[model samples]
Target: MTRRTFLRNVGLATVAHVVGCTKVIPELAALTANSVNSNTESKSGKNKLPKWKGFNIPDYFQPDPWYEIKHTPEEYFKWVADWGFDFIRMPVAYPTYLNISPKKQFISAEDVYKIDENKVEQIEKTIYLAQKYNLHVSLNLHRAPGYCVSTGYNEPYNLWNDKSAQDAFCHHWSFWAKRFKNISTGKISFDLVNEPCYRENINDTKSKTTAVPGTLYHNVAKAATEAIRKENRNFYVIAEANNGYAAPELADLNIGQSCRGYYPYEISHYKAPWVYPDPAYQPTPLWPGNMGGRYYDRAAMEEYYKPWLNLVKQGVGVHCGECGCWKQTPHDVFLAWFGDVLDILTGNGIGFALWELKGDFGMLNSNRSDVQYENWYGHKLDKKLLKLLQSK
Candidate 1:
């Protein structure tokens, strides 16, 4: 059963409904009202407000309650509303927008992936779905068209350092901004670029936490933000730091805006398969100590994410745009870290979404044939953890 149906049957329908939508959620109403006021610029520069205070959003493939999709948008909306999420994070990759030959040769959409048209539509539908569920949506460029600084997906995660590639990347955002101008300042929030990187070279014997293709990220973010701002001024334009891993010690990054600055969610990449794998990935116990845990405990989270937290506190809204683990990690490890991340977020009155509801990330582990999926991994969703996430 869907979480909403499950909750209503248990007597929480009064809190589950959304206006114009069948769901009746006072929390959403209150939240919408709060968002309205929150978006308003405060008269006193000293007073704080929030940009966003909600979840990261479910994966594009899964919006909580699993189901077959005969109609993409309709099925998706039903799926999302069923789940108790206040927002949906729409992670977009750059290739979605393609321009043939900025060169002397003839240019045409033919050079791009055919997936573009339907992809944009799917994104449009997702925003509507979020509203249908009384949830806000963040349109994040997961792996930008070219410059993927981090090494998650198998894409040529390099061009991040190339100028031409970076320009193409910025133009990609411009393309999207134009394509979905309706979503601009409307339902979708813009995220500059995914986690960038500039680390101390290992061989050089100097490594840094929050380091990556420096100005490239900054310029692209500025470019992407400007592009979106030109089209939509009200919607949030989120900025990320190098290493999706939050670094309290980093000097140049500041995601949230409290006059003092803040880093909403600290880098919680410890042990994540994206960064680390099971013992198999790291043959020795001596794994690179660079990244290996969830947010540095709660206080550390507050301290590091606090400056950003103040942005949420200020109403610019802070969205933990991404966070999820693969099946390789131990369930205990997932729970301990996710639980900590969730607690720090809520206790501090921040909002977040699970990295994914389903997909290869193993939020649902479709392939039960695997040992890890059959065993401890599936249990990652402990009752306590599930209940806490559904709380927001």
Candidate 2:
């Protein structure tokens, strides 16, 4: 079977498992609620920075061959600041900041991993702009030297297996640490990697091993963290949970843990071009409805977040680094889920940055067919979702 077909089968199997174990939903919800309440009191006065509530600036630095800046950094940063967001998660592609061309034939690993000075200057400018606008920026390496979640690119080495790739990864973070050593942790932070994971079933034992010591990803993260600390001890490090940030590992690192909020993938990613789950068998996604013998609803959403809540209880700073449904999802349904998710995150004092600011899954300016557009920076704004997002 093709990769898409295999993934579709996996999705169907997941739904089957959820349907078969229907009784666990309420149990998970209760656990989440209790954990949220207890952790609220326990986590008091832990970190002085306000919980991150913001949007991701997508397509700015990823997928290489840089795209033209649609909106000026000043415009975007000011917009985020004026909208009351506390931070902006900038997902950057490593190649854009490197000296070597991605297509270049590297004679040696050293040639492959050189940091580019001009690119560094450009990133420094962005940080300065963010500081001027009073917005906290989380610099994230979305596409590192040897790995990227996106397809179509030929990465020469596997970040998980190649020693050179791992060293290069640490070197990149270390360079940034020294470059921005003066920036305060409250104003700038490092998100070690974006959505670190292997393509394994969520419940697979091998996937669980990513959290254990000596695992490739964990080792890389620990090494990078130590490398950054070596330059700037005050820098805040944010680590994403493995497997789409769903698995509850890496809390022991004592750094902030970034979690994803794309639960019930059928609903959040319905009809998304990038997601394929057997179009022949995929059911239309709906909030609080039955899907293949399983009941899916707000409570199920709460259940999905239980693991992250548990991590929060462990005193690890938790942030939903990426969360939001596709624009194609019915606007009302999207709002219902979004509101419930915000309620959960805010109630638990867990912060979140929506999937984007102006693209698909965006709150401020989205390209959903259902909504009437009001042009802002060449894109249309969804005032309804924007208002809801800013609402208490």
Candidate 3:
């Protein structure tokens, strides 16, 4: 979900309900498509990850159950496999599957461990379906026990400092690791958290959100990694980079790292309602134009990625877990900027997953005004964008 949608759905939890397509595959066929294998530790001593390309499945992204848990249709999976994409990152909201209080208030320390098996089964079904299509699933907790980058719901405790929250956070990861322990690491991996950043007040939407200290971030991630390993040592674990778009700090551990592609916020989030709160501040984006008081272009992009590139040189596995422009940007500008983004990432042997597959920033039904879309299987396909992504 985009920042706009998350903020809009913050207080609608009471009325939220499950809604989505009910299309189901009658039979679970044997895996016909080739799933990418997990790479071993590199000579640099960091675990290596496959340079997989695909899209994010926001099934459980919204924490308040605001959107459908499984919005992507089965046919979309077939299309992803047919298009040569090999990855699907599912951002899960823990609240959607937890047995929260009837009032649905902030989960207290005593109430955080209750498990709702039925909702969890729904998650498992979706993962297996994606796997059936030969797509490696990266299960991520977009909303964890005590923190979420999106300031929609109020978490009971601060994950960075509260021991209670940290325990609960580790509990959730352990639950998932045990739940899918039987699955092969090649078919699925666990992303510990999504887009973690430092927020003095997590419930205050207007407060400053900055990067957490490297040591604190490392401690939380290391604890969570140990939690997952205790349940199943073979479970491949990934810790999203601190502050989402920055370089990862957990190179001492065997877990992989995930990064973001939404650099130069002016381009990726141009005029996005949640981003540009004041319309007068939203500048018309240009590929090589001056943005945020600097000349922005491919050279600037290369400079931006220098830290990530340096991390890869040290033998750490890295992937762009979320990258794409909001549909508000002009189509031509989006393509030009995104083309460079893809080129730089792929040229460095890194892979990326577009923020979504169907809505807003996606390959189908993006609702952008400037693109001439092609009709494919009754869905409007962004052929130009697709060609660009497929080429990478």
Candidate 4:
């Protein structure tokens, strides 16, 4: 469909354009205007803005090519700050930080694995950017190598079943705590794992229930967190359960005062072909009942997300760290969802980093250029959606 026709159906939406130092973020401006319906400061003076509405920057928009060499953090973050994002979520793969087989023969590896000198340097770079921009930065371990959202390695990672691997993971955390401990000027934090998925579904041959692995994964997180705190007294640390999304009822109450947990929901992944029928067709155009009203929206905050939001109010500081409906979920649905997300996050005390700055389903398309952002299957970013987060 032509971009004009698609947008006409939605009425007020536009892609964010970076025009040098300033950005023509028309999409966000529109979302702020329409998505939020309530008054910010009450005439009588009672309402307040909650903290969970913040956005993220991680593997999706790192300054350097994640798979290869180093890059400039200052130049990259300068662009990030231009986008009006309040925080940066940097997802670093631990293996990239260190070599696979540095000194020990613990695991059978034909090659070598040593920590890259540039990796931590880049981390320090991120810390500097965060401090300079007044942006909160959460350092997350995106790939633990042996475990992740899906099976990428041949070893059949069972982080719950393997005690040795778990210990190895803990040791890595200890090292990180010691090295980057000073990076935390209170704005920097350590996120335990990017998306700790521990399920038999990785095999496809095994029938898996969601409940089993999450429990074990949380226990492992608890252990790793304890190990980190042993060294750094007040540095902030975030732990995520097996699935990316969080459940207030399931959280371990013993989490440290300075530590919080995050949850990852596929508000952007609904009916998304990535999780649906054929992995080839990406769901777009905001089909009638497609995501219907889910649009990864704000209304969900009142009903579906209350459990998680309550935790943040209780001081858990729950973070979605990752959230965004398909760039083309459907205008009405997108507006509803985006508005709800803003209200709920701002209403409570949660902090969230959008799944990306730009990409397949990001706020911006890859190459940092402006193409129509999809609100549904084929729909592009509309002004209405962008305005949601910007709303008072």
lDDT score at residue 239, model 1, on the 0-100 scale: 68
Clashing pairs in 2: none
lDDT score of model 1?
0.42
Tens-place lDDT per residue, model 1, 1-392, is 11101000010001111111111112211123323223444523222223233334333322111222322344544444565555666655444333322221222223433345665675666567667666676677655544333332223223343444444555665566676676524456566655544323211112233344344444445555555445544345666644543333322222332111112211223223433325344421112122334323446545656555554544444446554444444445455556666565555555565555543332443222233342323333234334545664
At residue 300, candidate 2 shows an lDDT of: 84
Whole-model lDDT values for every prediction: 0.42, 0.64, 0.75, 0.46
Candidate 4: tens digits of C-alpha lDDT, residues 154-202 = 3334445555456666766777777766655356667776544444432
Q: Which candidate is the best by TM-score?
A: 3
Note each model's CA RMSD in angstroms: 13.6, 9.8, 8.9, 14.0
For each of the candidates, give the backbone clash count.
37, 0, 0, 47
- State candidate 1's TM-score: 0.58
lDDT of 2 by residue, 1-392 (tens): 10011122121111111011111112111123222222233554343224788878754454434233343457878887888877788888776666766454232456546678887787778777877887788899876766555543445665665566667777788788988887676788888877654433322312222321224445567677777766666567888766543434454444677877777777777777657535556667667787667888878878878777766666667778888887778887788778888888777877888888866778655667888777777767888877877883
For every model shown, what is its TM-score relative to the native structure?
Answer: 0.58, 0.80, 0.87, 0.66
What C-alpha lDDT does candidate 4 achieve relative to the native structure? 0.46
